[model samples]
Target chain A: MSAQGQELQRQGLERPGLQLQAQVARSDFVLDVHIAQPRGRVLAIVGPNGSGKSSLLQVVAGLVSSAQGIVVVDGDTWMNEDTFTSAEKRSVGMVFQDYLLFPHLSVQENISFGLRSRGSSRAHARATTADWLGRFGIAHLAERKPRQLSGGQSQRVALARALVTQPAVLLLDEPLAALDAQTRVSVRAEMRSHLSQFCGVTLLVTHDPIEAMVLADDICVLDQGSVVQCGTVADVTRHPATEYVAKLMGLNLVSGIATAGTVALDSGGQLVTTNSDLTGAVLATLRPSAIAVHRQPPQSSARNAWEGVIRDMEHLGDRVRLDMEARPSVVVDVTSQSVVELGLQPGQQVWLSVKATEIDVFKAHDEA
Target chain B: MTTAATRSPRRSRRSKPPWVLAIPAIIALAFLLIPLAGLLMATPWTSVGELLIDPVTQQALRLSLATSLLAAGCALILGVPLAWVLARVQFPGRPLVRALVLLPLVLPPVVGGTALLTALGRRGIVGAPLESLFGITLPFTPAAVVIAETFVALPFLVLSVEGALRAMDTRYEEAAVTLGASRMRVFWRITVPLMAPAVVAGTTLAWARALGEFGATITFAGNFPGRTQTVPLAVYTLLETNREAAIALSVVLLAVCVLVLVILREQWLRPGALRS
Candidate 1:
């Protein structure tokens, strides 16, 4: 194969990028999103509650009409002011949050629904449905009803139904939100591997940061019906554009004084961070897992150490959360085994230690 | 021993007569069934075979069956579309239109007979034009019997079907639309199937109403034997001549109605067909 062909085969997609801009007015707010993604790439939309992530995904898939703007995919204008394509006509496949498999139809028949809509004859549609079932490893479930299947199995059937028509763009809305936590992890990994091999523009909407980080090639953070930030995972983790995003990343974020190389705290303290280049008031973030708790002040080269009383204790599976009364409040995660070893309990005194390199500093914005 | 002793007071507080709620339900059942029981008890069993075999009575029963079945079919064909409109469509006077549909249901059957006559009588307003244009006279005929039955029975079908359509989720229709089916196709394939139980129930009720139509048929068609005198009219005419025969005919009507109700309850009120 030629270089371009090889690249196309490797990426599993080679088409023109999709361009979309929309302004949709709802009862409470207006959702405005502008996005562009190359073919074969997956873009994840992540946001907190009440963000218009699902609405934006629906607009791009032509399930809903926008009040303004257009969606152009692969050189074809799917929607515009004067002209619009219906959901069935647009080559966009959507996996709904609830995975609305037709209750009256069997798994095989459900998979054949979109293919039949595309004008395939019954015999041809049957062959295609069988092939998709085989591809999803659900051939044995061809005759089963959706209500009879496990959550993961039903999700796979939903995916098979969406992809049977070979749509040019795929939309998944909280696809794994219905699964149990253990199943979510394994199913999400399988979904990521399957999606990576798809030769179309894929958009996944989720509130789970882990799902977004694991599944998306690029992340778009949405808040209150607007795109707050859009970048690669590394860029977003290094610099979250909104307070919601920072909280979703589970960073112990504090905004206060930063002068020279050490930043002073609002509750009276100073700590060193990796961002020595910053010289003004800044926001600092560090993960709870990155901090270490000590019995006494250890003679380490780490720049962050403070005495604090444990305010709360929470047991989360194998780990325990220790909420300490440090400056601006400090939270640390320790293994349950270590909690037993250290005899950590609520109201106990301890020394909290964090490395300077682990602290990430950014210019503090008053609003966020 | 202490725990067992402590439980008696709590158990006493929990004890309430569970049958207290059945009192009103038992009274309602008696109110509905006592009249039918009275008719059954008064039936002259010795004369029932003779009454049923009477030539005029047999002719009226056949005509009643023919015209009521035809009327019910007509109601099904026209009423379902009207019900769909009233339930699903939006218009300025929708509530008013819905109320108008139920007018015949509440209007005295004799009043409905007069209304049908004014609309379809040979010298009546629109009927006059129809007669002049087509050389047709609709009054005092079997056709008039069918018209009167339809007039009184159509509201049952429409009301039942409209309630079903209103309760159905429109999301299924949208899903069908997204699956590339046109609106008409969706209605025929999805909406109709989902509303089948209601349609069947409404059809049976309307047919029963049409079979027993008396006032409208007597006023509109003027009680012609073998043409407009159905079973109900036949029973009324026989009351003056032979009270035992009339009582026997009432028993037949009651049996037929009870049988229909039992069949419908068994078929449509079961697990799969219980539509909201």
Candidate 2:
């Protein structure tokens, strides 16, 4: 076999991942982020708007000119205090939110741009570009400019362009955020298939919970420019440590001080939680489905109970959600039949109760 | 779309554009075009071809073409880099530097030519050394025609390209940089192509300005037949000796000017002005 064929066969035998530690200071916020994703893994970064998700991605791409950071991808140090590699030399591919396809160039030209920039001959770039255009299922769009493309097609072309370089690290900033709701579902599924086959470390930044949960194997929750929580999707959702993650997971979050099996809610209430590891300040998260409503004081053995008026009610899919005006403004999901039978109405006073074991308490972490 | 299609005609009639603004716009356009009309009226059409073939007229026409193209080339070579520096770089006195760059645009052409003399003439600051060491005197030369043309034409090119550069969506270059393109490659591949319309507009403006250059050329580079006399200088000199020849020459220049204005509106300025 030829030496080139041998070298091609030797690649992808094993792959390394990315390790990022960045301390970037922007005008509105400061990002103190540390994340590690194994090779062949898509780590999703879910954050609220202006929470420094893109800033972190920029730092990893080596685009931020002034930042204290060490970016290592596949055992190669791309940046540090004294030594820094420019974005062009770092072998990082980024997909911006708007796709940012060259409006002037056709699809093939856009994908071949990276290969051409790396000093490849035009014929070789054309061959490689043809392969990518087919892989992304945009072969029919090779001659069409960006304006002629649909939102989904533009996104696919963007992915093909970023992946054509075979970068060691991939940074995708809300890749599907610009798509309409109808297109986002199918495009996200297709993107999941493509991301699964990629061997490089991928950082996916998004504000949509469904996209994050559907695309990534692990989730990194960033809030106010810090990695507030990082864990498996199930771990972070089940025991959320911050209000932002709790909201993303649609769980009721209440912060307070914990003492002797009782946690004092910050908004003028108290809870007898089942948390054995409760300490000084803590945040208690409870699933809305865990709370039971009663017209009168219940004779059951539930630990935490409160009496409040219903502020409002919403009809969720297959269920009714009652927003009670209790301390911390708890939300409870009950059956539609139960709402009708109990005659639930706004401003109706009622007692709400939760079993002690249902509440999960964790240390409260205030944002910097 | 349907509403827009139906409403535009009615809207135009409801408030017949106020005569206050309409009258002035019409007067402004007529004021600019009346001189060309007069030139056309005076042009000796039957004798134009014969008169243009005269040796002096042919020499001036050829020199004008050669020198103007050269001046436009010089402006592009120097002005593009200067425009990039002015548009992208930030340092102290940047505002002052920009004001200085624009000073020549507002300066009188005669004054600019005189200034160029002190700076580059045979006995001038940098020109004296060339005369002593290299035996080169710049005045009354074709090179000086190009120099004077560049002086007046450069500001237009610099201003146009600088505006385009400032208005470019730099994210495209950022995307290229992330795709492993060096800064130079990004500037050439992404930045230049995106700025193509503006560059074309700027180059056309400079070329047209150079082709019609009069005061600066006559002041810096003396009229010496094929050596330095351009169409404008020849026209000015002809008016003193032969009125009919002068009118014919003016007719040629006016035709060229009309062609330039048409091309500017249809090709160079249209796309760049709309997008920018």
Candidate 3:
């Protein structure tokens, strides 16, 4: 295949997929988004709490009608202000965070439920269920009730049940959020594999950065019901459009205190900034690595430094994290080499320093 | 050693029970179980078989079974929908409607029978028109038997199924809905199947209530030998004529109740039993 053809195939757009542009207002939040996924590509929506991610999914699936705007999938209008199709009429599949398996149905029965609705014969539904169960490696669990299955097994069954109907689009709402940390790692990987192999557009929503980075071909960052950023994983990681996204992606953010050229730490204290023209309390963010820890008050031209004690220390891979209870109790990241060099330990005294220019400040919104 | 010492000290204090807590539980158990035991002990065992085999008794038993079963079946058909509407949908007077469904359950059975008679009897406000238009009278017939039993038993099924529906995770229905299944399909294929155990349990309880129906059946359908006299009515009539026969009939009813209870225990009450 040519490069363009390869790219098109990767997007899985044998037919055009969904295009949704809608706005719904709450007393305190406004949901504004315009997004489209190529026929079979996976679009991951990432956001903090109250970001309207689930509402967007509900609108597209026709569970909730949008106050205004359109939801078109594969050239069919599922939801428009003038026309609203019920959720039942939409060929969309959802995998809820809790799995939502029918407690009374066996694994096989759950998988065959949607198939049976499509006028398929019992035997045919059973056959389809058997095929799906086998494909998902849940055939052995076919006769067991949902309550009997482990979390991972039930998750696979739920996925198989959603996929058995061959829906045109799939929506997964924080699919791995209910699992334990250990189970989430494996289940997320398995779900990612299943999603990638399936030939349908999938939209996965999560607040977990690792899940979005691993599973989504493209990421849409929603903040307080609005799309703050939309791009590939690399683009979102390299350049976040909102303070929430920056914090979610593990950036240490602070905001300017006022016109005094000093940015206030989120906890307390203030840092003199290099940007003299920036007024108001602006959001400031920096990588943890950008801040360095010193055992004693070190003479440095960096200009921003505070003396404090190491409140805590945690091991993250090859690095050691030091929580310094300085003016603002800032977290400083350093190599194990530096930990050994500075003899860093919890309760050890330390001084923290950061370059004034390393801080990036932007105006913070007073209202959501 | 430290964990064990700390746990045992806490366990010792926890194991000591208050007389105040034990008194109510003991009284509650006795209050519930004593009547059942008395019913069993007072049964005239010697004549029980003969009383059960009497033609009149047999007829009453059969009528009771047929009417109660029919009523329970009807309740299943209508009550499930009522439950779904009450549990899942929002509308004006929803709370009032839910309370109204339980009206028959809490109202005296005689009042319920009277209510049914006034609503559907030959000279009833609506029934008068129905009678004039269709030349049909619904009182004192087998149909009346079914209606009376349904009136008394439907609330049981509705309450049980409604509780199950309310407790159910609605996300499953949403999942099925998004899977291209219509609302009706989701109800039948997902919601109903998930609630099968509660439905079955409710049906059995409703059937039992209908079988023992006395006041409503006697008032609405009358104590006709084969048409309306259920087990409870038969026992009442025999009590007037023959005390031993009445006691024997009670034993038979007791045996059936015990059998139903056993079935319930095995099928619905057992821990870890699969509902599907």
> For candidate 2, lDDT tens digit of each residue in A9-63?
2332233687777787867878888776788889999988888889888888888
Off by over 4 Å in 1: A1-15, A144-153, A177-190, A251-368, B1-25, B44-50, B242-248, B259-276
Clashing pairs in 2: none
TM per prediction = 0.74, 0.77, 0.73
- Pick the lDDT winner: 2
Q: What share of the true interface contacts does each candidate keep?
A: 0.23, 0.79, 0.83
DockQ of each: 0.25, 0.62, 0.51
Question: All candidates' lDDT scores?
Answer: 0.79, 0.84, 0.78
Top-scoring candidate (TM-score): 2
Task: Sort the candidates on lDDT, descending order.
Answer: 2, 1, 3
> What's the ranking of the predictions by TM-score, best on top?
2, 1, 3
The DockQ of predicted model 3 stands at 0.51
For the second chain of model 1, what is the TM-score against the true structure's chain B?
0.85
Q: For model 2, what share of native contacts is present?
A: 0.79
Preferred candidate (TM-score higher): 1 or 3: 1
Judging by lDDT, tell me the better candidate of 1 and 2.
Answer: 2
| Candidate 3 per-residue C-alpha lDDT over B152-193 given as tens digits, one digit per residue, 9 for 90 to 100 | 999988887888777777887787777667767786777778
